[model samples]
Target: MSTTPDRVALVLGGSGGIGRAVSERLAADGMAVAVHYAGNKGRAEEVVTAIDAAGGAAIAVGGDVADENDMRAAFEAVETAFGGVDVVVNTAGILILKPIAEFDLDDLDRMHRTNIRGTFVVAREAANRVRAGGAVVNFSTSVTRLQMPTYGGYVASKAAVEGMTLILARELRGRDVTVNAVAPGPTATPLFLDGKDEATIANLAKAAPLERIGRPEDIAEAVSYLAGPARWVNGQVLFTNGGIA
Candidate 1:
């Protein structure tokens, strides 16, 4: 394979499962990654150390993705570290499951704060700071399509993410940046499998044609492709689910 150019990426929530995988994958693919974490600096540092051990470049940055000033500083830190950023993958989010009638207003607010407003803040910074030919990848969940009963609030927030992703692509018409979302199905992450029983997990896995849960690496592969070489794929929500639809 030909060598990849010197590129930089800032992955929000890079300390988490899917985010960490994306951080490692992008670094392996020859990009200097800025691993951004909201509350887990140690985990972010671990990712950076692992990348460095593998002869790749990475740095740990911390901030609230919902805070504009914080996210702006993050973008600046990445630019200062690696010249400029070429890709931004926002994996920062929160999940609270409850029936619509049983949902606490506070829970709905929190979910929207991270998943909706947080995405806008991150995308705003990326829109202004990312170099030409860069890509912005946001995260969504396949639950929006599955339309499960208890997923009302969670699915609502992701629907907003999908809307913004497509609109942002149109807004960046001349800048050559691709804006997209990755809506992953049931993945085997701590955040995903936390409260579920084995039986429930098995049912979800079997629902998909692949008959298995998605690995963090599987979603990371999609992010890597969009960040590096999937230029023609713009303004779309790529469902990395195993044919769950």
Candidate 2:
């Protein structure tokens, strides 16, 4: 509740299911949002329009998060429009599922390009440009703990994010900025539900004590906490999975 109306957030992957939820949640909480998309300008624009319709401030930005130049321009655009960037929520990622023995190296390469390289690209930008008293939220996954089959490649990328995020939190010493990651379990988003049959989905839903998969808004609530009221929290990977772990 200490958040102000002027704080600005650049939500990378803001066009996707979970990312859209994060963007809207941040805007609703009073921050002007720059909804960043990789290749979907229209999807990003839709989020911006929704925020505008809700009487909140928002704009859409485009970039490949794995590219440093693109991300730098993204930060510059946000700073120019909003005067400064205070929060960065990177919900951007790629998830490819296949058994490790059968996984293609090219798939791993592609996933790492976005899920790992892309995350750090934005992290570096936020560290250099985010104003004081800002927040940086990275995304992780509960599957890193679940050790689920066919998730090895995807989990590897997120685990890297978890490591880099914890280290970055300490590296930002004296900057008064908080860095953290949220790990959600089997969220019912396109990212999590795609390519799965009903039986697989049902099994995942029952894996959690909550007896259901997470909602995008459920995960967004955790990001809102880290990005807004939970200043004392830092350098941690929060498992926002409804006790799936």
Candidate 3:
């Protein structure tokens, strides 16, 4: 919400379902976007193409959020393409759902690497580099509040993100930057729907007060609001879960 006109935004994980939506929404809102992806270069290019077709400026960049060098290169690429970045939206994360007792240690490592460590790396970079009057929007999950079974690992990772967002918001006090997180509920993304049966998915959708699963755009709308106009909304986790949490 603290962004300036003609500002640039870097969307980490811009190739995924929610990430693509966030990239498009930010572009529509008139911000030149830097679309970042880790493994999906083609999908990242697709997002860039859409933005360009809409007469918006965008470029696709690749990096792993957990690597300092990778994120540094990503930021450098954004600056090279759009002068300097004013907003950073970190949607790059992994969700590994399993009972704690049976959860694979390797899976735990992967989730932490991408969700917690990656978020910290990106947030630290944003804290030091983003221009004044900028905004940093991180991703969390509503499962933290719902405490759903088999979501222990994923929720724990996002909880780290939430804590970091609050601390960073205060850390950016004199710099005129706002840091927040968007906690979305069960959304209809490939990541969320991959292995579910029709009946199970329908039941989950009906559980929300809205009686439908979230769309990526629904979450993107929240990101757009926090990134552009909600100047006083720092240090908050805006949940876009349709009242499920």
- Per-prediction tally of clashes: 0, 0, 3
TM-score of each: 0.97, 0.97, 0.97
Worst 10 residues of 1 by lDDT: 1-10
Residues 122-182 of candidate 1 have per-residue lDDT tens digits of 9999999888999999999998888999999999999999999999999999999999999
Runs in model 2 lying further than 4 Å from the true structure = 1-5
Please provide, for model 3 over 39-154, each residue's C-alpha lDDT reduced to its tens digit, 9 standing for 90 to 100. 88998999999998998888999988999999999999888777798999999988888999999999999999999999999999999899988899999999888889999999
Error of 1 at 142 (Å): 0.5
Give RMSD (Å) of candidate 1 vs. truth.
2.2
Candidate 3, residue 167: lDDT: 95
Model 1: colliding residue pairs: none
All-Cα superposition RMSD per candidate: 2.2, 2.1, 2.4
